[model samples]
Target: MPSSPARPLHLAGTSPVHALPPEVKIVAAFVAVFAIVATPREAIWAFAAYLAILVVVWRIAGISARRLAPRMLIELPFVVLAVLLPFAEGGERVTVWGLSLSVPGLLAAWNILVKGTLGVLVSLTLAATTPVRALPGGLSRLHLPGIVVTVITLMLRYVDLLVAELDRMRIARIARGDDPRALHQIGAAARGVGGVFLRSYERGERVHLAMLSRGFTGTVPLATAPARPRDWTLALLPAGGAVAVAVAAWWV
Candidate 1:
C-alpha cells in the first residue's frame, strides 16, 4: 500500500471547523486578519477581543494551546526584531528601569508584534482545519487564475518527492563515509544541491511531456462542493465580530 500524502500543519479531526468548506474558511481567515491589521495599535482591548474570538474558534476546533504554542515559535525572528526596536529606534525617549526606550518605537513594535502574531495565528487556524488537498479547490472557488492554481497543486503534490530524493542522496553519501554537515564538506553539499536541482528540472520536463500526451490542459481539475449559506454565516461570524471591534477601537 502507498503511504498517505503529507498534509502540512493540518490536524485531523471531526470538529465543526474541519467540517466547514475550505473556501468559507479561507475567506473568514482573510477577513479576520484584515480587521486585525486595520485596527489601531493603541486599542489594546480590541486585540484582546480578537484573541478571545480566536479562543472560541479554537474551542470549537478542538485545538489546544499546547499544540499551537510550539508552532508559534516560527515567528521568533520577528519577535527579536520587535524587541530591538524599542532601544534602537530614535524619537521621544522614556526611561524604563534606567534604560532609555523610544515611545513611538514602542508603539511601532507593539503594532508589529500584535498584528503579526494575530495574522500568523489566523493562518495556522485555517491550515489546522483545512486539508492540503482541499486548497486547490478553495483557490478555484475564489476564482484564482487557472495557471496559478495548477502550479500550486503540482508543487504541493511533488515537493515531497524532491525531499525524499534528497534524503536518499544523503543516505548514499553517509554510506560512503561522507558527512554532509562538516564544514570541509560544504563544497560537496553545494554540488549535491546542484545535482538535485538538475534532476528536478529533468523530472519536470518528463512530467510535462507525459501530461501533454494525456491531453492535459494548463489547469488542474479541482472539483469541490460549494459552501452552503449556513457554512458561510458560521465561518464569518467571528470575522464580523473582529470588524465590529476594529470599528469600535477608534472610539474606545
Candidate 2:
C-alpha cells in the first residue's frame, strides 16, 4: 500500500500508529469508544484517564491536540443539546445566580458533552492515521455483514462522483443566469436539488445494471493481505488501556 492514499481526511504521516494496519486501528478506536460509553458519569476521574490514554495514542500517532480540536466542533449540536438539558430536564432543582437548574440534568449534560467529545476525538484519531481506502478492508476483516460492506464500498467510491456532478450542475445554472444567491430563485434551487437526486438515482440504476452484466456478485470481495508480525499486539495496546480504564472506573 502507498504510504498514504489520497483520500479525504487521511493525513499522510510516518508515525508508528500510521504504520499499523487499518483493522487494528478500527478495532482499537471502537474499543476506546466502548470503554467511554461503559463508564459511569460519576467516575469523572475515569474519563480523565481515558483522555490521557487518547493523548498517549495521539502522541504515538504523531497527531497533536491542536489538529484534533478544531475538527471536534462537529459535535457542536450535541454540545448545544447538552447545554439545554440542564434547563429542560426535571429533577432536584438547585438555584444558581437566581436561575433554577436540575442537579441530575446537569450531570446528564456533562455526561453527554464529555463522552460525546471523547468519541469524536477517538474517531478523528483513527481517520487521521488511516485512509478511506483501508476502511472497507478493515471492516471486512472484522466480519461486518457483506451487505454493509458493499453499501459502504459503493458510497466511498461514488460520493466524490456525485459531488462533482452537483458542482457541474451548479456552474451550469450560474452560467444560465440562475442566481443561486438570489432570494427570488428558491424554486430554481429546489429544482436543482430535485434534478441532482433524479440524476443520481438514474446513475445508480445504470451502474447496477452494468455490474450485473459484468458478473457482479452481491458482495464486494475482501482483499487477502498477508498478516504482518506484531500488528495485532501493538493495536491491542490502546484497547487494553481502555479496558483497564473501565475496570478502574468500576472498582475504584
Candidate 3:
C-alpha cells in the first residue's frame, strides 16, 4: 500500500478518531472547549475532569503526551501572565511560600491558565485528526456564513505561498549582505512584510479572476462524504461528558 503524504499539524492514523467525519470532529471540539470555558475557575476539580476528558480523547486518537506536551507550550505567554497576576493584582491578600498574594488575583490567574491550556489542547486535537483541506467542508456543513468560509478556505490555501515568498525575501537579504536578524534590520524586515502583503493581494486578485473565469461561485463545492447519525453520536460523547462535568461543578 502506498503511504499517504504528510501534511502540517496532521498525524495520519488508523484510529477511530481519525476515521471520524471532519464536521463531527469540528462540532465535538467546539462543544468540549465551550464546556471547559463555561466551567467556574474556582471549581478546581472541574478543570481536572476536563483534562481527564481530553486525555481519554487523546488516548482514542492515538496521541501521546510526548506529541502534545511540546505543542502545549504555545500557551506560555498566557502562562507568564497568569504567573504574574497573583503578585500584581490587588485584592484580599493571602500568604503562600512567604509571598503575599491577592486572593482574587490567584483565582484570575488560575482561570486564564487552565482555560487557555484546555482550549489550545482541544484545537490541537482537532487539527491532529482533520486534514487541512477538510476544514472548509466542515465549516460549510456547520452552516457558517458563505463568505466567512470562503475567506478561511482561501487563507489556508495561500498562507504557505506567502510564507515561501517571505523565505525567499530573507534569502535575498542574506545574499545582499543584510542581516535580517540584526536589531537595526527591523525596518528592512517590516518592509519585507509589507512587500509580501502587496504581492499576496495582487496574487489574490489574479486567482479570483481565474476562479471567476471557471464559473466559480461564492462557495466551494464540498467533496466530503456526509457523516452518519452514529458518527455524530460517537463524536459527541466526549463533549457530553464535558458538559456533565461542568454542570456538576456548578451544582456542587
Candidate 4:
C-alpha cells in the first residue's frame, strides 16, 4: 500500500479516537482539562489518575509513547518554569541539595508541572488523532461564534500555503547569495515575510471570489452527520474518569 503523506506533528491516523465526532472529543478534552485545572495543587494522586487516562487513550489511539516523546518535549519550557517555583515560593523553606526552597513553592511547582504536562499530553493526543479540517466544524457544532470558527478555518487552510510561499522565497534569496545566518540578513528575512503575506492576501481574495462564484454560503457544510451514541460514549469515558478522579482527590 502507498504510504500516507506526512501530516503535521499534531495529526496522524483515523483511529477510533480520530473517528469520534469532533465536537464530542472537543468537549471531552475540555472537561478533562477543566477537571485537572480545578483539582487542588496538592492533588498528586488526581494528576496521576489524569495521566493514566491519557495513557489509556494513547493506547486506544495506537499512538506510541516513542512517537509522542519528541512532541512532548514542547512542554519543557513550562516545566522548567514550574520547577523553579519551589525555590521562589514564599513561606517556610526546606533544604534540598544545600539550597533553601519554599514548601509552598515546591507544592506550587509540582501542581503546575503535573497539571501542565497532563494538559499538553491530552491536547497532543487529540490533535494527533483528529484531522485538522474537522476542528472548526466541531467548534461550530459546539456553538462557538460563527466568526471565530470562520477565522480558525481560514487560518488552518491557508497556513500551509503561506509557509510554502515563504519557503520558496527563502530559497530564491539563498540562490542570490543572501546569507540568512548573517545579522544583516534580518531585514531581508522581514521583507520576505512581508512579501509572503502580500501574496497570501491576494490568494485569499481570489479564493473568496471563486467561492462566491460557486454560490458559497456563509457556513461550510459538514462532511459528516451529527455524532452517534458510540461517539458520545467514547468521548465521555475519559471525561467521566477525570471527573471521578477530581472528586476523589477533593473528598478522599
Candidate 5:
C-alpha cells in the first residue's frame, strides 16, 4: 500500500501556481499530457520543446528537478522496454554492432519513450503543485464519475492507517526472530501480506459501520470552490503553450 502523510499536498507559500484554482490546473495538466502523447515519435525536437515548457512550470511552481529526479526514476522499467523495441519489433533490418535491428521498431520505441516521459513529467508537475485533496474535487467538478472520485478519496484517507498497521506487523515478526531476508522465509512474508489484507478488510468494515452510525453519506465534501478568472488565465498559459508546441511540431 502507498503511504500517505498527515499533511495535504498544499505547501506553505503564496506561489502563483498554488494560487490557481485546482480545476484549471487539472485541465491544463490534461491538455499538456494529451499534447505530449499526440506528438510524433520521430519529433525529437518537439519533445525537447515540451520539456522546456515543463521546466518553466517547475520553476514557477518552486519545484526543483533534484526533487523530481528520484520520482522520475520509477519510469525506468518502461524506458528499458522502449529501448528494446528496436530489436523486438519486426521490420526492415539494418546491421548495427553485428546485430540486425528493425528501423520501424526502433522508431516505435522512440515514440513510447518520448511520450511516456513527457506524460509522467506533466503529471508529476501537477501532483507536486496541487494538493491531493483538491485533485478529487477538481476531477468531480470536471464531470468525472462520482464513484471514481469517491473511491480515490477513500483510498487516500485509509492508506496511511494500513501502512502503520503493516509496520507494526513487521516489527512483531522481527521481534519473534523471523528473518524475512532468508530464502525460506518467503512463505512467512506471504502470510504477513495476507494478514495485512485481512486486518485492512476488518478495519474497513468497522469504519463503514461507524460512518453508518454517524449518518455518513457516500460523498466526501470538498472545500474547493469555483475557478476564478485569474485561475483560468494561469491554467490557460500551460495549455496554450502545449498547443503552440504541437502546432510547431506539426507544421514547422
Candidate 6:
C-alpha cells in the first residue's frame, strides 16, 4: 500500500552540491559515468580513482554510503546477471579453493558490476542534490528538444495525481470486501489498471483543453532564470575531476 504522496528522489540538503545548477549536475553526472565506462575494465586502478572522485562528491553533497545503498537496488538484476557470467562463460579457467571459474568471464562480470554500480551511484548523487521540479528547466537550458522536456515535465507533474487516484480506487475496492490478492481478483487488478489509464487519458484531454483556452503554444516557457557564469564555473569541478581521472587512468 502506498502510504504517502509521491515525491521526487531528492534528499534535502544545503551543501554546495545542492546549490549547483541542475544542468551542470546532469552533465557532470553523465561525464563521470562516461569516464567510468570508457576506462578499460582491466585497469582496476583506474576504477579506484573514479570511485575516489565519487566519494569526494558524496562528501561534498553530505550523502552517506548507507543512504545510497538501498536506492542502488535498481542495479540488482544486472548484478545477478553478472554473477552468473563466471559460471556460464567458457575459456581459460582459474581455480579458487576447489571451484574453477572462467578468467574472461570473471573479468567481464567484474566490469559489468563495477561500471553499473558506479553509474547508479553517480545518478543517485545527482538526484539527491537536484530537486525534481528543476529538472525540466535544466533540460531546456541544456538545449534539449522542447517536446521531450514538455512531455517529461508533464509526466512528472501528473504522476502524483495518478498515484493518488489509484489509491482511492483501491480503497474503494477493499471497502467493498474485494480481495485483490485472490485468483479471481487478478482480472479486477488488470481492469483497475486499464481504468486508471482511461481516466488519466481523459484528465489529460481536459488539461489540454484548458491550456488551449489559455493560449498555450507548442511549448510552455520555464520561469527559472538561466545559469550564470559563476554557476557554470562551479559546475565544472565535478566534470574536470572526472576528465582528469580518465586521463590519468588511461595513462597508467
Candidate 6 Cα outliers beyond 4 Å, as residue runs: 1-8, 167-185
Best by TM-score: 3
Root-mean-square deviation (CA) per prediction: 2.7, 3.2, 2.8, 3.1, 2.9, 3.0
Task: Write down the TM-score for model 6.
Answer: 0.87
Candidate 6, residues 1-252, lDDT tens digits: the string is 111244346888999889888888888788888888888887888778778888998898888898888788899899999989998999999997888999999999999999998889889888888888888888988999877887888788888778888888889999999998889998888899899999889988898788789987856477677777888778777778878877887888
Candidate 4 accuracy as lDDT = 0.83
Residue-level error in angstroms, candidate 1, position 14: 1.4
In candidate 3, stretches whose alpha carbon ends up further than 4 angstroms from where it belongs are 1-7
By TM-score, how accurate is candidate 5? 0.87
Write model 3 residue lDDT over 1-252, tens digit each, in one string. Answer: 111232357788989999999999999999999899999988999999988988988899898878778778789999999999999999799999999999999999989998999999999999888888888998999899988988898898887777777889999999999987799999999999998898889988998899899998888689978999999999999999999999999999
lDDT of 1 by residue, 92-183 (tens): 99999999999998999999999999999999999888988888889888898988987788787788888888889889989999987799
Off by over 4 Å in 2: 1-7, 168-187, 223-229
Q: Which residue pairs clash in candidate 3?
A: none
Tens digits of per-residue lDDT for model 5 on 57-83?
Answer: 888888888777767876899898988
> For model 2, how does the per-residue alpha-carbon lDDT over 33-80 read when each residue is reduced to its tens digit?
998999989999988888898889888878878777767878999999
Question: Judged by TM-score relative to the true structure, which candidate is superior, 2 or 4?
Answer: 4
Give lDDT for model 1: 0.89
**Deviation from native of the Cα of residue 26 in model 3, angstroms:** 0.9
lDDT of each: 0.89, 0.83, 0.89, 0.83, 0.80, 0.83
Better TM-score candidate (2, 6): 6
How high a TM-score does candidate 1 get? Answer: 0.89
